[model samples]
Target: MSDASLHNVTHENEAQFGDYFALLKPRVMTLVVFTAFVGLLAAPVSVHPFVGFTAILFIALGGGASGALNMWYDADIDAVMRRTKKRPIPAGKVTADEAKAFGIALSGISVVMLGLATNWYAAGLLAFTIFFYVVIYTMWLKRWTPQNIVIGGAAGAFPPMIGWLAATGSMSIEAVLMFTLIFMWTPPHFWALALFMRNDYDDAEVPMLTVTHGRRATRNHILGYTVLLAVLAIATGFTSIGGIFYLTVAIVLNAQFLWGAIKIWRRDEDASEVDNFVVERKFFKLSLLYLFAHFGAILLEAGLTRYGIEVL
Candidate 1:
């Protein structure tokens, strides 16, 4: 159905609370919360438990606000894409204007509350993150270029840095490493999904790598980025955040990730269609575990270090 028609569809029931919450993209928010939590805890400085909780809460709210704003702007494309056709705005559960208002309100509340709970620097980062995602990524880049994910990925990478800043009120090598990890990881992850989802971007008119560059080039890009990502991930283990635990996780996961990328690079579309993009699908799923395990290892290292348990 056309976006206009989708928006005009009569609804039998009003949007429930869950519909509004769905505007926040809870799955994406989970990543924001986890990485931010890791960043906060991994910092050298300690924070009061209540303050830390509130800081994370406000950061999550800021992330949710960004998601809402993204949905507001992308509703048209969302309506066209099978993956997103069921989202609140596209599904006629919420109006674009309403999503925009909710986003703006949450943005203000989260930023101000974060400033009150922690420091203005952390709040400023959070504010910039929301603006970057909503304005820079969603508005300017998403439909404009194939390189969108590469550049726009920076917005997602800022959460851990914000968390680190919330704790220490300054940046560090560790924080930058965390940011870089996510930034480098985003393209290949989304590209793999694009490969499997196949025609979604084409239908939606989004200039994803798979749409513009073709699957062969997209696979090449994934392999190239995976190499770079593996280097960065392993190199991070040598930094202050690196310990025996993190190093082990990094080495093992990167090997699996790199091998997956290689398999993706070697396969043709015929093979992919034969197995229903099994390699691509597995790589996509592994990408999720790959990130969480890396961050989880860092968190564990921090915990062990706090008790003077040497992780070297």
Candidate 2:
């Protein structure tokens, strides 16, 4: 082959690999893996190290499968949305049929592997999570209602619970509390993004709150959810899974999050436009830190408890 032709082929091959990986939504998978890992470690039951590793791997695969299926189903909307226009399927780097097949394959493999590595209960939760994200949220709720994220958040919230179950093969209040923390945190987190990316949702014709309700109403909803989230998050710090370390982290983060939400609620659209949605963007970024820090603190508490180092 000619040198130029060989170079072109190499570039295309490299791009193809990256594009397929993109379909998995690796960034989202990071949260899945982290939360699941924390959940497993935080459980009172001990899991073998290798078993825990494989369990988390399978769980991450399940999350990635959900992302791929979501992209497959939502390719049309994704193509139209500024934020999602370059996703592999929408960018024409992968076919919808291929994505669908890839997702289904990953879903089955992840579920079966997790069941073998841990228990069928955790696998069942993983399967349900994939189904909820792909069929319920992506295909039905996302286009159908402005409350999509509220109900759909359960899919994401399942990872830690699944992790807990993988460790203990049962449920507990601590697992439920971890699940609720993410569940309550989801709406405001996405709403802050919607506040800044209203036009993207509008263009995609997705029924996000900012598009259905006015920005004012969206702001109100953010504050409302943030208040509830703060309450739940701080209260979780007192649970069996929580400690002085967790409670201290929760108090500081929730205070900052509530303050951010209040700022978002008080601002008008004009002020937002004047500053290019700076507050919304900051809150959105802060939301990312908020969850990670909370989980990290929980993981620390778990480690301390395991070592018989009382954090209280």
RMSD of each: 3.8, 3.1
- Cα-based lDDT at residue 187, candidate 1: 96
Worst 10 residues of 2 by lDDT: 6-15
Clashing residue pairs in candidate 1, if any?
A: none
Evaluated at residue 216, the lDDT of candidate 2 is 93
Which tens-of-lDDT digit does each residue in 165-189 have in candidate 1? 9999998889999999999999999
Q: Which portions of model 1 miss their true places by more than 4 Å?
A: 1-11
Clashing pairs in 2: none
Best candidate, TM-score-wise? 1
Q: TM-score for model 2?
A: 0.95
Worst 10-residue lDDT window for candidate 1 reads: 5-14
Give candidate 2's total backbone clashes.
0
Native RMSD of candidate 1 (Å):
3.8
Instruction: Please list the residue runs of candidate 2 whose C-alpha ends up more than 4 Å from where it truly belongs after superposition.
Output: 1-15
